[model samples]
Target: MHELIVIEHEAEAGLGFFAGWLEGAGVRCEVVRPYKGEPVPERAGDGLLVLGGAASAWDDEGYGWLPATRALMARSVESGVPTLGICLGAQLMTIACGGTVERGTAGLEIGAGAIEPLPEAADDPLFSALPAGPWRAVQYHYDAMTALPAGAVRLATGSQYPNQAYRLGERAWAVQFHPEASAGIFASWTGTSDMDPLRVADLDARVREAEPELEATWRPFAEAFAAQVAME
Candidate 1:
């Protein structure tokens, strides 16, 4: 069995930078996607990660097998394995852990933006190493977790979003943004056609705008996340 169990949803969406980091770190990784009729991971998985998708956490139980999927996540958490959730993955985390996830006050968050670290992040093990102030990351989501689930510690917030990130107990984390996104992935998400812009029209503009800056920011988050997995 691989040391990590990564749950992937959506057709094109796979493990992002996190997966790359794990592979680079020499950690064996396996992907499970219910959309492809993959099985829900059991306790055998050492660490768990849920990737983002277009689906909502509650839209259709069968489309993504969210109920059982969430149960699998809960089992992983209860078993004390480290787990991470992104976007839809984050919503899944909230629902699995007895927290409520609803539409955010901010309509939609698309493309590169900033998520400020919580005051307490300076002392957090998983987040302490992150850059002190604002950090930019790729984001693409309409639904976000407003209220944290029970047993969760709210670690970070942003100007537009209140519940940007949180930790379940000590080992699990959920973030509304994409720490795993890369230029290729972003381009895949936001087509070159104006019909589907990244955040706004001619959004391909970001490719020229923040490529260097975003890559610079993505490294620390990736490294910090990798460090947490190593801790586990």
Candidate 2:
């Protein structure tokens, strides 16, 4: 069994079903809440996961722990570790791997949305088993990663967001949406500061409407991550 390192950025953005998925696969997880200034472990296992955050990846000074976090993710990439990042975590991974993260024009997608498979995704090992066409994924990010790093494969995209998912090197991957989110987890995200009251309510309804499909997609995504961990 592989030991997974999960970085929690906010009180709301915890691991959700990710921890359960890993445990189900007989993997151990050690999560660190860096926003609370928690102590950073000197070493993270080869399998690493970085969750979302309210803070931007550019604001390393505001969140002083960013440099350290980036260092950890960078090490994971360079060491051939299987690293996965979600939302802001994805942006962090992009920045760590010499990519650009900037404000997106989509204005923060709050509810369930679609991600289409890229032409390059056909050869991807991780995404090969996943469904193509419009698949539902939960998102709540204002900023996005623009260009991908070298050797990164563009796996998925949507109408509004161009780069929904990408894979770095062979083992490192990052997605702009949250595959770890469950129904309860999406409910907890119902009233975040970034979303207005009316928009939040509408988004929650969309989440409920799309719950089944979202869960379906998330199941394989979670399984893919688990499989990557198992490989390490």
Best by lDDT: 2
With candidate 2 superimposed using the best TM-score fit, by how many Å does residue 112's alpha carbon deviate from the native?
Answer: 0.2
Candidate 2 residue spans exceeding 4 A from truth: 194-196
Query: lDDT (CA) for every model shown?
Result: 0.75, 0.82
List, residue by residue over 128-228, the lDDT tens digit for candidate 1.
76666687777778887877888788888877778888888777888888878776777787663245433454554664476677666666665565565
TM for candidate 1 is: 0.88
Off by over 4 Å in 1: 192-201
Assess the local accuracy of residue 44 in candidate 2 as a C-alpha lDDT between 0 and 100.
71
Tens-place lDDT digits, model 2, residues 1-232: 6789988988788888777877887778888887777966655785888999788988987888888888888898898888888998899989988999988866777668888888877777667767765688888778988888877888898888899999888888889998888767887877646557887788788887888887666777777777888887
- For model 1 the local lDDT of residue 98 reads 88
Best by TM-score: 2
Candidate 1 lDDT for residue 218: 62
